[model samples]
Target chain A: MDRASRGLPLLISRLDKDYAGKAGPRPVLRGIDLEVEAGAFITLIGPSGCGKSTILRLVAGLDRDYSGSIRVGEAPIRGPDLSRGMLFQEHRLFPWLTVRQNVALGAFHCGLAPAAVDALVRELLERVGLAHAADLFPSQLSGGMAQRASIARTLAGQPRLLLLDEPFSALDAFNRLALQLELERLWQRTGITMILVSHDIEEAAYLSDRIVVLEADPGRIRTVVENPLPRPRDRVSPAFNAIKARLFEALHVDTGAPFAVPTDPAPEEAIP
Target chain B: MSMEVSSGGLAPPGAAEAPRAVPSRAGTLSHPANWRRAASHVASVVAPVALPLLLLGLVASAWEAMAVALHSPLVPHLPEIGKELARIFRGGHFFGEMAVTLLRVGAGFTIAFAVAVAAGIAMGRQKTVAHFLEPAIIVGLTVPGLVWALLCVIWFGIGLTGAAVAVALSIAPALLLNILQGVRAVDAELLEVAAMLRLPLRKRLACLWLPSLMPALLGGARLGLSLAWKVVVLVELFGLSSGIGYQLNSEFGAQNVAGVIAWTLGFAAVMGVLEYGVLAQLEHHLMRWRRTAQV
Candidate 1:
């Protein structure tokens, strides 16, 4: 798709954030710096309270009370814009609206004619496999279906960058795996600069082009691991396991725990 | 990128088909289980109306027995009140009076709703607005409907304006409180989503704020309407020359027990229709999404 080339590179420098605690200003994020190339898939994986989601929120411009330089392409984000879309842990579909109406909200500012907007909504619903459930309210949908609709809503604006804050953490294993695959496919097709915050090691290994591991207690990036596995990575492949093993080592280094070597078992044994 | 992996175990096969196969037509009614289901549905629908009517019947019978035994002029027989009620319906004068009263109620309630919503939203959204309005709202809540009616009658004189203003003043504070609570309780997460999407203010109000406030709006309407009805009648009784309230006042002056009872019952019936027939149906339709959530 030609839109694949529309992704805008993001730059963040010297980012510092603080929260007003009872004692004094508590540092949440400190001296964070990262540069993401256009159309790259990046995952921020870390333990809880490591400020991964906070970073995503900052990049989305939902919270601007931070000392940093965050630029999408060449423009500094003043507030949320149509060019950047975000998905939360919860589906966040408006409970009062049907799937179609909720998705249409994303395109409300696109200045399209009503008919064109309708067609675009239908196309997005179809792409998300929610065409059958388009008229269903958020309450009626299963967890996975609701999240799919949310993805459709996020994609409706054709954003050049997408931020996901553990978008599938609430789902069952089966649904999580399904959505992960769906997200990977969407990333490949749209080539949107994507950033996901997750603590799931395998999830980070499976989807990220680069995983930025973070440490808590005045949160900052510990290391960035570049994935060597090719597209359509097999879960049981030796290379895939190696990358997962490397991520485990990086994560465990902060906790002062010895990294357990991953036992390379047969594919049949790995299926469990 | 493989489609095969996601296609399985996402949505169970035939899950969507189950709701489609529901037997909605009479063709499937002949089945025994379907027959039982239909009977149960009918029973549930009828039970609420049936129980109230049964109690009313018993009360009426007891009143009639007592009236006959006493044989007093003060306690008219049940049949006499029923005859008076029928006459009020048949006589065209009563219809005109009822219509005048209904128009006043409509005007007053509309004014109250508009003012309450405006003030409620302001108070709910801004801390300073809420602080400034809180004491006045509390005082408004404490004042009786009778005082408002009498004050409006004194100020506006014997006219539609007196009755309508009385009703609005008496009811606005309660409705404002209801709407304030709803606005304050709006989900913050959904709002963040609205912000992240860059939804315009107008769209946010329509899709998010208004729908989120609907239950409270409807609840306020129900309470406000009931209060407005009583206040409008009180204002009309003392000040206005034409209305159901005026007729009841005249009946009281004449010491006609049956006439007063008939007018009271007739007004109650109209109020019931407005509440159940109009407001209840609207609430059901607007809140259908919430009902589906429970299932």
Candidate 2:
């Protein structure tokens, strides 16, 4: 249980990234600066082209081509490490392996003995409410079940910092809400510093301690809003709506006009 | 209800009764309709075996008719060939020859598989390795198995060594091509997952590469084994003095057409057992996950 407080702080400064476009190297991210405290939940919310996911990938060391500094607990990321676990939008489970095997793979490099690894896998499956589905392959799992199994796999690594790239965006509204609750509970229990990339305003408001709003076209941080809402947040609460309205305003400042699609027009109208 | 009644009224009594009677008749075991269904079900089950049997019967009848018409010793009847096959099985020397041929095939095929896998993986992973080996693979594929068999016989001077070498040289390119395609076709997303996990090379091979490449490897093995059989027999026919191919050669030398046919039949039967019995079973077991996933 001591590992519950093992979350590592992250620091990023003057980060710049470019992709090899058809014409030439095109800038994707520019002047990106952010800091995350240990055991804090941070959500990066932006429009579609904003380099939020790219920033997550860079921090995870999946891409090290960026020019700047990204340090996790005083060490610059050389490459992907066990300390950092990532979840993609897709479950990304190996179809050949059973759920048990996939979860066990997360613990492969942890240097645990075979029996210990087996016990860990069992505990993880149980924790994720997937004990009965342990022997099932990814194909046999429903979308929500598969994502839960993926979460178990990531947790098996005992990561200090968990990066989620729209991990529940593919799920239906009900499953997405269910998983969001589960993810919040997981973050609270494990105390892992979590960074999530999402476009969903409510999702960002519900989970994050600090929501970093980003602007597209050379993605850069626009503002970071501190959430005053308490834990076990109610979706319909006025306090939650206030924070969502702030995030929505931050997201639409660049467009001369207001965002056309108002999720909750009541809050926006009230603000005006 | 009114529409149904009107339609029922519009139809003839016999037509209405006939539709109901058809289902009732089909439900009865003794009915002609039920008998026809049972016959069709049995036919479906037996069709695969029956079609091949019918073809074999046709071939035999044609051979028998040709033998009767020509009245030649070279064109032996099916019974004469069957008798010769029985004679080959009865003789202890046939077993020894078969074992030798099989051993050579096994050795050659193993060599081909090992070399192909290593080379294929290297070529698939590294562009430099691929560029360096592409021309050699192309040339190897282009050259006929007969040419390799002749060269190997000349180089190794007639023995198991010569025959095994010929088989390996002849089939390795095709196997390599198969394995290379497999390696290339490996899922990139899964690989990215492995990289993100920082899985060790050993684990990566066991969990990711091996399973991903399994279908291709099995496919290559099947193709390579069949090719190995033909090449080994071919090399034995010309180079070695003891094998089924050697027996065929000896019979042909003596103008014993029945003996040649019998040896070929024996070889074909063994190949059938191996293809269906061993390789197929292994493939089914290894790929059981895929079958279940589909279900």
Candidate 3:
């Protein structure tokens, strides 16, 4: 509570979050110090239980248990606010709402007029290429399409920061690459500060400007590597391979993933 | 349907960026009028029904031939039942009794439906409330309908109130449990989304909760309807003042098998009409989104 950032843009000077008293004695996130400039694309990488999602949740004000402070421009985050947008791996579109109604909900609590919200909803629907399905319910959507609706709903509030928790980790190979590519273009166009949580080293390599790799158990940042790949990053390029290798090493995947090779195989066998 | 699938498919991050997204739902029927769509809807329904109708005809023929071979008065032909069914439509003293039974059942069922849905939604939304009240629901469900009718007679002293209460008590527990389970089974991620968006509570209930709970509600209604009929008849056979159940009891006492069979067929037809013409229509409208999920 003592530490305070004096109007110093989105500072996290020695941020520590713990959950020791809940059941057993343990902290979900401990001794985490990170900084992101305005409109930077930062990716958080980790193993399954590395608490990367916890870190993002903390920053988004969804979880308030912590030691060190997180100040978004001299203001401490206490609860979820309109300034932060979040998307999860499973698209959480409300089943009762049409695509339009679900997206419009983001603006429901705001002080905007109804017409403005309606116009914005239509504009967003068109942007997501779901203008025609705007009146359709979430159950009517395909998995990929539902995820798009989730992203559109997240962006509806025009939040200053977008926190994504493994948003594309559940998708098939084709959808994953397509969404990642779309994300790249969106990030370039929007210039919003983004903190993406992902387990896939290759995904972090291609999508992030700066990738922070984490190992589990204690959930500490193992490596903070700079992504040197050029824009419109080629996944097959040597530069991309080098970064992906570093991410793998940080995660201690020396013997390869417990299941099998995670890399794309061939055109027809790409799903494996 | 294709449009609905693709509309949700473009989850690629760029779809809502750079003012340029590939138009996936562009060519789909943007808004098919409810009336214009009814024609295709009827065709879809008829295509499936044509087979069942044929099967029913075959079954009726087999039953008639078997009855003839046996020369048993116990098994009557379909034509005799059809003639008796026409007689039912002519409106006799028995039909008046049936109308009274329908009215009583209708009142009891309506009361049960409203109370159960309300209680269920409240319990479903709050874990604390559900935990506290669940024991009472289990007790209600375990107790038999006839026992409740007996209790009602003891408590309310043998009138319409006693019979209706018996009907309500019999059906309410099933509906409550079914609706509660339905509500609880709703996806948690959707609630998280609702919380993040900060929707008005009413809109949250309508858009997120209601549609998800529809199947459970409909299931409860179906179960509750059958129970209503059974309980109403049981009450009449025992002590109800004037109803179809009393008529059945009298017929059974006199060993008029034809009269009993005719009433049973007539009641079965009523249930069939209600399910086919009413419940099916309601289910169709509520779960249209389910069709896309199937694809």
State which candidate has the highest TM-score. Answer: 1
Candidate 2 lDDT tens digits, B1-295: 0011112111111122111111333267888878888999999999968998899889889989999999998799888998998899895767888899999988898898999989999999999999999998999999998899889989999887888889999899999999999999998878878988889999999999889889999898889888888788788888788888888889999999999998888888888888778888998887766634323
Better of 2 and 3 by DockQ: 3
The residue pairs that clash in candidate 3, if any, are: A96-B207, A144-B9, A145-B8, A145-B9, A182-B14
- State the lDDT of candidate 3 residue by residue for B1-295, as single tens digits: 0011222333333343232233553334546754456667887889778877888789889988987898776777777777766665575765687788888788888888889888998898788888888998999999999898778877887677887788899999999999988988988877766666766789777877888889998898899989999988988888766787887787678776666777887777778888888999999988775644323
Best of the candidates, lDDT:
1
Give lDDT tens digits, candidate 2, residues A34-151: 9899999999999988899999999888898989999999899998988999999999999889999999999888999999999999988777667778888787777778888899
Worst 10 residues of 2 chain A by lDDT: A263-272
Please give me the DockQ of candidate 3 compared with the native complex. Answer: 0.23
Clashing pairs in 1: none
Q: Evaluate candidate 3 and give its CAPRI docking class based on DockQ.
A: incorrect
Give TM per candidate: 0.91, 0.86, 0.78
Backbone clash numbers for all candidates listed = 0, 0, 5
Docking quality class, candidate 2: incorrect
RMSD of each predicted structure: 4.0, 10.5, 8.8
Show the colliding residue pairs in model 2: none
Error of 3 at A245 (Å): 5.4
How well is each residue in A2-73 modelled by candidate 1, as lDDT tens digits? Answer: 855778899999999998899999999999999999999999998899999999999898899999899999
Descending-lDDT candidate ranking: 1, 2, 3
For candidate 3, give the lDDT of residue B1: 7
